[model samples]
Target: MTMLRDQGIILINKDSEISSAAVVAQVRRLLGMKRVGHCGTLDPFATGVLPVVFGRATAAVPYMSEYDKEYRCRIQLGSSTDTMDREGEIIKQAPENFDASKLEDPSYVEQLLNSFLGEIKQQAPLYSAVKVAGKPLYKYARQGKEVERPWRTVTVHSIKLLGIYHREGFELPCLDVLFSTSKGTYIRSLADSIGSKIGCYAHAAELERTACGPFTLDQTVKTADLFDCFEGLGRDSKAFLSASIDEGIVKATLTAFAGFPTQAVELSDAIKLTHGQEIKVFPDDITLDTVTFTYNNVLLAVAGVNRGLAKVKRVFTDSSAEFLREGSIDEDI
Candidate 1:
């Protein structure tokens, strides 16, 4: 098989109890490549779609990180946790007479969920990687210290209550909810917010990321299947790993840039782009905020159009195949 060592994005169905970084490390070791990275982080206890980029595709992380995300979350009411998730310590419990049935009223739940449909303020959880005074919030949490977390604005595109269910050993009411949110929206925090609105404490019992921008769960390969492919190669391991940059991954990477307006550039201009040179474009021809320049059917660089000139915002080099910036893909999911 031909080694398509160009650029590609592999969608891995990350399993729970493992950090996103662990998944990336496993893929990096299995693929035997150093230029590998991911787009978003999923908590260790969370599972779902994780897009791992290898080769020149790693340069596209910044463009892919801003995509809206979709998650299927399980929120249990009547108790709260220090970490805002099931893995955290139980910090508080609802009053003895607290009623959880209020969540059962579809109308009431819908109204409450609707309140968060637009932009709202959220405080980073104590257990999150969000930094405070140059230190990770989790560090302070581990030391049993509390610090004031600044509130940030985030948008919740949509929320749908799937159903209300009961867990075997837990007496609290559990809600299965699907959320479509802008990047950086924390489902754990949202669950706690919903609990507060319901007059009971709550925490995220489970979380599964179903989609990240153009990448979806259906496009992901199971972690076990990926390992099987690697181990099955035997003496052909190197060749198989090199050829694993299949068409699907290539397509996925291209899809990440599909939102940008495309313009074909001559070979001369393409070379200029890689050298950080600005190129000329028709002043009135600009129709979008940003444009993707291509040469010979391969995406070369992304540019921001101002006035009549196009400035290179990001350049892609096929030979280097190294990550240009740090993003997620290994921290959480």
Candidate 2:
């Protein structure tokens, strides 16, 4: 088995009961590449779209995290857990008679969700991967140690109450919620906070990521399907590679040149130049005469305009000098 050192975004429909790292390991083994990494971490109990990037595609991680994420979450009201999820031990329970209408009451639920919108303080659950003193918080939690975690402000773009179910024999109501939030927002904590707001306890029953920015569950491939695709490609085709030296790369390079850490920006202004467009070089302190852009560090294409701005030329999959710097030497030569 040969690994395709290819660089591109891989959409994964991550299954439950497996950690995100586990999925990456599987991909590394099947693809026979060690450069595999994921954009975000999904809990073992949660399932849905998990984007994996291989080789130079790992650079896309920060960019992808900025995109809005969509989730379908189920919350059980009236009971609380240490981890704020069903996986944790129940810490508290409230009376079952707590009005189910509290979730639907415009005066209550709306206020609660609204308060959570924009910027607000949140404390992560103890059984989380958040690091404390160089150790994961869960390590302390398992030993029955309590660590003070400062609250951080996170933004919730939108929260919609999808459905409210009243389960008998349970002290509180259950809810199905659809939410779109900025990165780093914890849905488990949100459920716990909402329950607290309503004078009841709650914990997350289920969570499925529906979408993350441009990537969606609909576009994700199962682990099995990915492995099958890899095997079908065979050895020769496994050397797949792709590159793009678009505005994103340019911006990253410029940031690095300016002595600042590279930051990923959503490139909406990048226009693929066609043939015959004028290549203009501005007289500035920072000028990148030629830049190498890659998907996973695999040279895809280079972009620079000719003297005439009338049309742009795009040489796809061709490693020509036009895309290379003056001093760059071709390894093949």
Query: 66-110, model 2: which lDDT tens digit per residue?
Result: 667888989898888998988998988776666666565655666
Off by over 4 Å in 2: 1-5, 100-108, 167-171, 228-333
Residue 199 of model 1, lDDT score? 78
Q: Give the TM-score of candidate 1.
A: 0.88
The TM-scores of all predictions, comma-separated, are 0.88, 0.70
Superposition-based RMSD of candidate 1 using all C-alpha atoms, in angstroms: 6.6
Candidate No. with top TM-score? 1
lDDT of each: 0.79, 0.62
Cα lDDT of model 1 by residue, 205-277, tens digit: 9999999998899888876876777777772546555546543433434556766787876655667777778
RMSD of each candidate relative to the true structure: 6.6, 9.6
Clashes of each: 4, 10
Which pairs clash in model 1? 20-330, 21-330, 42-332, 42-333
